[model samples]
Every structure is written in structure tokens, then in C-alpha cells.
Target: MEQNPPKSIASIKEKLKKSREREEECATNLQLLRQDLIKARTAAIDVVMAHQKAVVKLDEELEENAKDLKNVHVHFLSEREALLSSFVGSLLRKEKATGKTPPQPDAPRFVAPLHTPTILCFLRTHLGKPGMLYCGRKVLECEDFMLKTNRERMELLFAQHRCFGCFLPLSVAGHLKLSDCPHPRYCAICDSKDHHQILCAARRVYQGVIPE
Candidate 1:
């Protein structure tokens, strides 16, 4: 009976040892799982930060592109205005010296049909008038003839490449023409909308410069 008791005690001790070993193994597995979880969390955070940076860079690039496009548009408009002014000035000098209106250039007319009447009206009012020069201003009273005339008005009227009223290029102007507002008037030199030639600021400045 004593021997049997000893064997039972030894068996119990062996079971206790095995139980402790199992506990240690479970703790090790839990620690490894915790480390894996921490690594996963770190990786996820890094990915989110990288994604945010990419988005910010994309936004910056888009803004820069928009600015570049705007600059290009402004440059194009200025070039068109300068070319038109030069062409008209040359034509006027030729016409005045020859005592006859010159032939119209064979350039492609890009102005819309709806805007044609307005251009024609402007031309009829100012074309071939005496003592008039293309100085990029609206009509003013001629000191000699007492007649209201402006050669610059004709220059802007024939500017089919852009709107002299709003200074919008043809591509944008074609899409934005107002159906209700036909025959809109503007200063040829300054591009002031809904203004008359007589009240044009540029005309006043030009008149001030004339030697009385």
C-alpha cells in the first residue's frame, strides 16, 4: 500500500511539471501573436501616411497645372490683341494715304453669325472717317471736322479672334455668348463691358494727350 502511495505521488508530480510546461508554451504563443499584431498595426499606419502624402502631391500638381494653363491663356490673348492692333494700324494708314478703303484681308472670319451685325454696325459708324487714327481708343470728336470718329473701333470690331467686350478668346467666347444680351457694347481699347465709345476711359486719356 505504501509503495502504491509513492507511485501515485510521483505521477502527480509528473503531471504538475507537464502542466507548467504547457502554460509556458501558451504564454510564448501569446507573446508571438502580440508582436505580430504590433507589426501589422505599424504597417497599416505607414500605408495610410504614404497614401496621404501621395494625395497631397497630386493636389499640388493639379494646382500648378491650372496656373500654367491660365498663364498660357493670358499670353495668347495678349498676342492676339497686339497682332490685330498692328494689322489695323497698317491698313488705316494705307487707306488714308490712298484716299480709298483697302480691300479686306482674306483671313478666316471666326466671329459667330449672331455677332456679325454688331461688327458691321461698328464698321459703318467709324470706317474711313477723316482725321481718325488707330490709337487704340474709342471715337472722339475730330478737332478739324467736328465729326465723331475712331479707327480703333473698327480694329476691335474686326477682331474675330477674340471678344473685345469681355477679352475672352474665341474658344471660350463661343460657348459663353448670352442669348438675351445681343449687341453688347464695350470700349475697344480697354475692354470695359456695357460701355459707350464716348464714355470710354481710354478715349479721355488719349484726348488729354492731344496738343490743343
Candidate 2:
């Protein structure tokens, strides 16, 4: 076999130099990649911190708004009570001065074309409460008998287009007399469209219809 050419010192030295240069370049690239990774990590941490801060601020604002709404509602109730008291007091004084009975304001009138069985059920459920059936009735009275009697009477009144609360005849109308009420029915005592259970306790107390 032919002998291989003797290895040259120059070529070997050149190969060694190229390998060393490649190693240096790889090391430099790795260092640059590590720096970029550290920067990305820092940026992610900052974003998370900012998001947490925003959430905390939003919660605080919501809490403050809720407190404001509660305060406003309480203020409104106080004002409404004061106005009602003033109106009642003025009416009483006017009656005393004139020495004539004040004309009772006509109850709100509405035309309820539909029979509300739900209202009857509600009245039966919440018996003996003010502005509800059995308000003045004794518990000893037969519950079934009373409900049966009232149910028949109410059905008759509904057919006759009469007010459920006062049994007064109602004027034919397509809508509620009270602007706030959605139902086409009215309660003189409760002055609400929801139910005409019995005489309203609040009205009785305010108008001096019942002794405090």
C-alpha cells in the first residue's frame, strides 16, 4: 500500500486556530442569548406588577361607589318621610281652622281587565299583616271560611270593575292611575299597584286614622 502523506505542522496549526475561533463565537452568542432572556423576564415581572396595581385600584373605586349609593338612598328616604309628615300636618291644621271635615282625596283608579289569582294567593300567605287580609280579623276566625268568603266577594268586585281595597267603582282606563305603578290596579290605603291587602299601616299611622 502507498504510504499516506506526512501530516504538515502548518495545516494542523491552522485547523486548531479555526476550532478555537468557532468556540469563541459560540460562547459570545450564548452570552447574548442569556442577556436577552434576563431582559424578557424583567419585562414580564413589570407587566404583572402593573396588572395587580390596576385591579386594586378598580376594587377601591367600586367600594367607594357602593358607599355613595347607599348614602344617597338613605337621604332620599329621609326626605320622603319629612315631606309626607309636612303634608299630613298641613291637612290636619287646615281642617281644624276651617271647622269642616277635609275632603278625602279620591283614591287612584285603574281598570284591571285580568283577574290576578297571584295577588289572592299572596294575601292568603301573608295573613294578619297590615295592608293584607285578616289585618283586623282574629286568628280564632275560621281561616278557610274567611278566605272563601273574601275570594267570592273579590271575584264579584273584579267583575264589576270596582277597587279591591275600597270597593269603589273604577273609571274605565287603559293604564294605571299612579305613574310609578305598572299594574292597572290601585290601592287607596297602600296606594300601590302590587296588592290591595287591607288598610295601609303607614297611611293609618301618618293620617291619624289609627291611634299610635
Candidate 3:
């Protein structure tokens, strides 16, 4: 309490310099850590973007593959139908009574496949050959409604029996004094198994009941 020690300026200056050096070092370390954190965040973003791009590419490839598969399926079905149609056409050609030979497949330009049904005429009957089915005859004459069939389809004609009365010719449906006579009922003409010959105009003419 009685005596005071002399202070040294050199020692105090040395302590101040050491404290400043420590604070600078801490600042540098913080800056390095911030840069590292930024680099890590950028890397993570790049990885996520890359993953998204790969997923999009895979989805596009899968879609293309699915379309290819569908096309293959359609082609397979088309080929199958063509094969069956060809088989049916071959059988019908063998049924022809003509001495003339069938047109060879390798002959020339194949209009359609060999097995496609067409309407081929042997004689007066236009029923044979390949073509569309006829449900009933109509009096209206048109190119579209005509029997534009092919020869291989002849077998399909007369496949089932219709009433003999209803089976009259198309032109006759309008000209004749006919009505749709129901089967198995008391009709004066179709009383027997054979065609109802009783409705013959000649019979009425002979009996003097009506004009011939």
C-alpha cells in the first residue's frame, strides 16, 4: 500500500497485438465454414436436378416401349385374320365345277389377299364366290345394292331354308298377287308339303273364276 511498481509500455503493446491476432484467426475460420456450407447446398441441388432428369427420361422411354408393344399386338391380330380368310378362300375355289383353272396367287398384282371372299359366277346363279351377305332381295336397283360378291362365298348362299312362299324371286315380290302366308296355318295354297300350287293363276283361268 505504500510503494507503486513502474508500468512497461512494451509489455502492454505485446498483449494488445496477441488479442488482435486471435480475433483475426476466428474471423477467417468462420468465412471458410460459410463457403463449405454453400458448396454443400449447391451440390445437393445439382443431385436433385439430375435425379429428376433421369426420371423424366425413363418415363419417356417407357411410353415409347408401350406404344411399340401396342403396334405389335395390332399387327399380330391383322396377320391372324388374314390367315383364316385365306384358308376359307382356298376351300371355296375347290368347289368350282369349271374346267378352267383358278387364278394363281403368284400370277400378277395381288388385288387383295387370295383368301378374300369374292363373288364369282359359274352360270346364271350369282350366288357363288366371295362377297357380302344378302339378307333379302330388294326391288330397288343400285350399284351398291347389287350382288357385288366374290366367287369364294358361294357356300354361304342358301345356308338356311326360308319359306318357299317367301323365297320367290326379288322381281316377283312386287308383281305377284302374294301375301306373307304364315307357315303351318290354313292357307289354301300351302296346305301340302310342296309349294301351294292351288294359287296358280292357270287354275283360276281354267275354272273361269278370274283372268289368266
Tell me each candidate's RMSD, in Å, in order: 11.7, 14.4, 22.4
Give the per-residue Cα lDDT of candidate 3 at 36. 99
Is candidate 1 or 2 superior in lDDT?
1
The number of clashing residue pairs in model 3 is 21
Candidate 1 residue-wise lDDT, 1-212, digit = tens: 66999999999999999999999999999999999999999999999999999999999999999767755654454456557656756767788899996666697322221222222222233444676433322222221111212334334433534444433444755544433234566444344455443223333333432222
For model 3, residues 88-133, the per-residue Cα lDDT tens digits are 5555466555555655666532223212212232222334336644
Best candidate according to TM-score: 1
Please rank every candidate by lDDT, starting with the best.
1, 2, 3
lDDT of each: 0.51, 0.50, 0.42
The runs of at least 3 residues in candidate 2 whose Cα sits more than 4 Å from the true structure, single-residue gaps closed, are 1-7, 100-212
TM-score of each: 0.49, 0.43, 0.43
lDDT for model 1: 0.51
By lDDT, is 1 or 3 better?
1
State how far residue 178 of model 3 sits from its true place (Å): 44
